[model samples]
Target: MLELLAPAGSMEAVAAAVQNGADAVYLGYGDFNARRNAKNFSREEFAAAVSYCHVRGAKVYLTLNTLLTDRELPQAAEFAAEASSLGADAVLVQDLGVLRMVRQVAPDLPVHASTQMTIHNLDGVKMAADLGMTRAVLSRELSRDQIEYICQRSPIEIEVFAHGALCMCYSGQCFLSSVIGGRSGNRGLCAQPCRLKYGWEGKADSYPLSLKDLSLAGYLRQLRKMGVTCVKLEGRMKRPEYVAVVTGIFSRAIHEDREPTAEEINQLQAAFSRQGFTQGYYLDQQGPHMFGVREETKEPKELFALARSTYQSGEAQRVPVTFYAMLRPGEPAQVGVKDPEGRVSTAEGAVPEPARTRPLTTEAVENQLARTGGTPYRAERMRVLVEDGLSMPLSALNALRREALDGLTRQREALPSRHMGSYHVGARYENRKEPPVLTLSVRSAQQITDQLLELGPALVYVPLEELAAHPEKAKAPAGTAIGAILPRIAWDREFPQMLDNLRKVRDLGVTDVLVGNLGMVAAAKELGFTLRGDFGLEVYNAQAVKEYKKLGFSSLTLSFELKFPQIRDLSKALDVELITYGRLPLMIMENCIIKNRTGSCNCQNTNTLTDRKGARFPVVNAPGCRNELLNSQTLFLADKAADYQRLGLWAQRLMFTVEDPQTCVQVTRRYLDQEKWSPKEYTRGLYYRDVE
Candidate 1:
């Protein structure tokens, strides 16, 4: 059976999930998780809580999924080591640094890649497997076919989000909150700015960016058939009642291999939902129908109360045990108990100085032993041996039973934790050297006019799709070495067109190409082109960067989510690029926000999505039927020119996503110190205050 995984925000949620039917429960490790805002557990709380789940036969995973700064990596690694020492089944990770340093901490602990890794393709899964990731939580945006393909090809186990609140932006990619006010979603502080009203020049009273809750209860059979190893329910911050109701519905559905009833579906909705529910990107259905805002509706009292009753008492009598006892006069009464896992414990009371009055009856002995009401164990069977005149004191009998059970509980928790093998250093590992040059990523050929090309940069990058669409408008003149930036995400529906565009760009004599996501690496390799990795490649650590360097990438772009110091440290390992100027892309939503309102994309080429705060975020109609939401503030790092040289980067990629040709020229000159430039509206972005 596919494992039914549940989220536990609190110890109470853990009890509810395990009692209801979660095969596994995953929670945060200290504060290093994607849900730091949740009432996460302290170290002591985590140790005690996991023990409670352990006795109930439920596996516990520690979530270390948030991105870690270089300074915080050691602490995060130490936390994983502690969790592993406490007997956690596995640790879910996102940052590559966590993946590398964790092995040094707990060598035998299983590391499952978190969905925030955005592992949407088989190549990504393969990359994880190559790095020794035992399991992968595929991106929630993957379709059923794509997921099945990855499952078939991936060497590691696949875990998918079975139910949860769907983020409008893909996991691990959104920078809206971070750039807006320093609250980074990648580091577990998501303001959920998507839920705020963002209009497309319409009167619709709905939140366009907010997708309804994803309910995959109706598709468990399909996932099971596709060989998914685990179905994860996404609500660690939710109430215990919410976790219980959601876990129960999915557990029953998975167990019976049957679709949930409509009543059960409504109960799930009533438990907690945005507006109603959506199946989300699993089926590859992205459109207006998949959208919904948070409709103010309380959870059904009956359902909430019912789920609450499932774990009303923290002490759940789940562990079954058998006991053997011998009571004799003038000797101690010894009691031995054995738990299900073959662990045995015995405790003996003080000498049973013969009962003074009313010799201890067999009925009284059974009564005292049966009072295992408050403990986590239930005595299924017990065997008693006694002499003809044995008279045990009630206090001694009670003490012996309590001591034996207590010893049994300690024995159960004392089980040794398994360690994953340590990471071995490879010969390919190398560090950065020399000051980096500069590259320009122009959105339009108009921005790459002949004059701008005269500045003499190392390389100029143009979008392959845009170049193919308008070779005349996007063409680079003679003597200009132009590299094409391929699209980041390649869906099945867009793969054909993307391949055609790659071929067209190849035929156009553009051999230098920059790859975006993992899939693009394979595509660019197949075309026999020089590959430059993009920011979307998510190179966060020295190990990950070295891996890419070993893969033959000419130069890689470090993720914008890193601080200047972190980038400098990673750059010391390999050639890397950073977008020093231009508007940062906040999200690449599959569902077009503009089309959701007008039912037609007129290609107006210029329109804004007005938010509740009246901040107008630029929307670009991306190729392959996608939409890109640009950050309202432009990322300008002209003042950090010396820092780039000090960091020893490969180059500073000045992207011109929305800037005009003249502004591109001005920005280029300013970067080169050929001309002075300053902007009234600009942001330092993560370069100053990185995500946690």
Candidate 2:
């Protein structure tokens, strides 16, 4: 059966979702979850909430889905183990390091790949299965066809976001909040900078970044038919009433196999909306219609009050239990209760005596046992074995029913035994004395000038599309190699053409490939090209580096979000690289910001989005007709060469985005000569400063 998964930021939210017909509730255990700002459960509160949900036939999924450093890995692993002991049905995780730690420490606890992992294709889902994830929450940017394609081929269960607030950038890929406000969304402290207004290409200020909330209430049945295991509702930061209202509507739609009524849609908007909802991504109709800012509106007190009254009453008939009773002349009367899962409990009452005035009938005893009012359970069926002329007091039968129900509740709430193992942080690699080599990654072939090549950088990476368009330009000095950089986001439908392109590039003598997303890793390996990991892998700790090494990556570029000290201490399981120059990409968006405003493609030109503070972030075209928003200030670290060299990295990549060929050459020259020159506007990019 398809599951309806709801978000629970607080204990009240847990009850609201469970009572309203959620099959499972995913919540934060502490500060480790993605919604750290939500009123997450305390340790005690988590235990209580788990018991509450379990007894009512709802599963609990703990959220440890965030990036973890080496120092926090052990603690996070221990938390996963604790959650397992507290009966968490599973854990959702983003970081490969955290996934590794959780598997090691709590092998019995199933792990799901969170949406923050940026998994959107069958290959990505298969890779996650290979890594031991039982389910994969696909990227919300996927269209209906893309989701159905993945679902058909995925080895593990597939989950799709049914209704939720849409992030302008893909989940797990945004760095705008961290770069601008020192709050890392990967660390669960997003300031929602995407919700703010900005100007596009010298145009007037407008809310171009904010996107309307996604509502697929009309598509749940279709998704179920497509073999989607679960549909998740996104709103952990919302109120309990919001959880109740939304979960109730979606649950009814799924259970009834029909769309929600007009009144329910009105209730959804009143609960919360960003100028109503959009199915833009689901229908593959993304454009200006998808952009909207949240407007202040009056609260729907009557609707919220009705929802609160329903959940808070705590009388939801969610679980169905069967009653079995036995009465004999000489033996004590006995009653047993069994839940749908086959968990049974029995209780004994006073012995039945010969009736003086009236004899007990099976109907009389069953009538008393069926009074399961004010409970989450309802008596679905009952069987009573009553001997003729046997009498049992009504009070005794009521007591017997209560005791049996209590025992059954205890049995239902019991935690499953899970194995816990030890986790030890691996030792750091010895620092190498050799100076790091330089590599170049350009947006287009035009950025590869002869002057830059004369510097004899170890390797030059050009996008696969760019290389395919200009196969003649796939040339470098004998000492420098040319590699193809795969697109950061590619749907499964594009894989056939992408494979053809990869083969063409491979036939061009390009033996190396740089892959930033997990979905492309298998294809790159299948074609026999050397694999190098990009920053999109989000390798924040040594364990993730080791994991990637195990995944067949010969080299990896560490995440730019890491501080210098954190990067310096990572264990070098394989060759590791860092970005040393050029503008850092803040967001890789599926929606084209330029096309939304201009209704045509002009991404090759110099375009930018100006914020309210006048900081202009460059926008460049990405593969698949998407857009990449580059940081306003370039990350220039030529003067910090010595500091980088001491970290013992294999290479320092100069990402050449939005830079002319001349500028790329100039920047490469400065880094090669170890010149102490500074650009008028440049940033260290979270290297010198810490992010929350």
Candidate 3:
């Protein structure tokens, strides 16, 4: 049977999932994790939770899935070592430095690639296998057939998201959150602007980008039969009641081949819903609606009553169950604990027992909560209660506990008990290294040629916008961008300015020009210019990279969001040199803030946005535009240099910034320099390959 993995934002959620029949639960504990907003487990909480899950025969996977910076290396590595020592089954990772740390400190622990790594094909799967990845969580954008194709060719297990919220952008490849909200999704501070209502700047619809949730309940059987190892549910942001219901539904389907009854499935909608559900990109083709259309749902009175009863008992656990019930005055209730064996022994009376904190009956709880209306389920305390107005029978309360216990027992038994180590820990052989080549980004033909005389990089990169910035430089036509002038320059005499610049760049020592626009490609070919792919183009998959190569570019930069396996696949499949080092550009936006037409943005300049963990950062919109300047994602891979070189990498690029040039250079040296450098603990940004 396939494993049913669930998300847990806290120890309460972990317990709830384990109790409700989740085979395994994935959560974050510290800096390297993806969900910065979730109530991540503290070291003690994490260790205790792991022990609790293990005792109940459930598995715990730590999330170390965020992008990392040089400064965060030590903390990330320490967390990895701590997680391993605590007996975590695996750590879900998204950065290369962190991957290396696991390979050293806890060489025996398994590493699962986080979806932020954006992997999608058989070649990518093979590359991950070569790097010791045990599993690859295929990208959400893949169709079922595409995933199946990869599964057939892959050496490691394949895991896919079976349900939950879907990102409009490619997984881990989006900068919208960070660019617009100041919270980088790559670093787990996602401001879900996608859910916000918006009027299109030029489109027909009022809410152009709002998408629906993905629900493949109708297709669970098909996924299981495809040999997919795990069916993941994606909602750490939801309440435990939501967690319990979803977990219960999927757990039954995957384990018994028993899908929810129509009414039960409708219960999901009643609990909460958005536009509705779609199979998402799993069907291979879709529009923005593949995300789902938003819809409102009302809670059923019966379900609400059930939830009220569960909450009043004070015996509630948070991980796997959500109580949804309405309460009235004078309800009878019992307080008790349910053991792993499915037995519930109600404690004597319904009072707050000092030792066990046994919960009160409905009558007492209602009286206490009367002023508050009712108590919503609190994960931290594992309690829920109806207001002073609710009531229910004692026998009915016992029955509810029994039902909950049964679900928990079954969920706990589904996960594996043994340790699953780092991605490449059990590899049969080691890889050989090859030094990387270099690429230079120049502002003009003069700078290009001058630098080339003494330092000839393998490729030359330039920005389209920059050409227009310096019109008098005699490099390109006035106002025509690099993309537009590339074809018109050299051969077109009317474009004397561009011709001079192109000729000078070639004379200087440049071997190739990186271009993204088709006009530039056409211009380069017409002018007989040497060309290499530029980072401006978002090259995500091997197919895309190959297409660019066929278009005549000699090399390509893979999307910064790609996982190690995806990187390895592109490296092995294409003959062109690939660049792998540098501080990754986590955000690229068409909407410019500094140059915005709007005098000011709608966002409050002094408003502080709080992440899941309640850590707050002050908000600041870029001057003169609706575009916002959010947090930036940092990239570092010094610890995994040998691993990357072995994958046929040619060179790495470091972005030169006014503030971070020295630091970027130091980090680049740490990875590219050949003199016997000792490996220091580091966090792997998006290149993490552990996908199990």
Give the TM-scores of the predictions, in the order they appear: 0.84, 0.98, 0.52
Alpha-carbon runs more than 4 Å astray in model 1 = 202-206, 314-412, 417-435, 445-447, 467-480, 492-511, 522-529, 541-543, 550-552, 565-571, 639-643, 676-680, 689-692
lDDT-based ranking: 2, 1, 3
What lDDT would candidate 3 get against the real structure?
0.54
- By TM-score, the better pick of 1 and 2 is 2
| Per-residue lDDT of candidate 3, residues 1-692 (tens digit) | 87889889877677567656788899888856778788888899988888777645568888888766434556776788778877788888665446665676777788887676565556445545654668878777677877776677668899998778876554665665654445667778888765654332322233334456677777777887777888898988766667767777777777678666787678666655676677756774454444445565565667645533432344323232223223333334443433444433332223222222433354443333222111112212234544432344444554545544444444443333443343222222222255666544432333433313223344335543334344333233232222222321111222345545665655543335665333245545666765655543445444344446556666655545555665665423334344344323333221332222233444433433333333322233321121222233334455656666656555564433222333433444554553334323223554663221
lDDT (CA) per prediction: 0.80, 0.91, 0.54
Candidate 3 wrong stretches, greater than 4 Å: 198-205, 291-692
- Evaluate model 1: give its lDDT: 0.80
How does model 3 score by TM-score? Answer: 0.52
Q: Top model by TM-score, which number?
A: 2
Residue-level error in angstroms, candidate 3, position 374: 28
**Local accuracy of candidate 2 as per-residue lDDT tens digits, 574-629:** 89899989899999999999998798999888888999888999999999999999
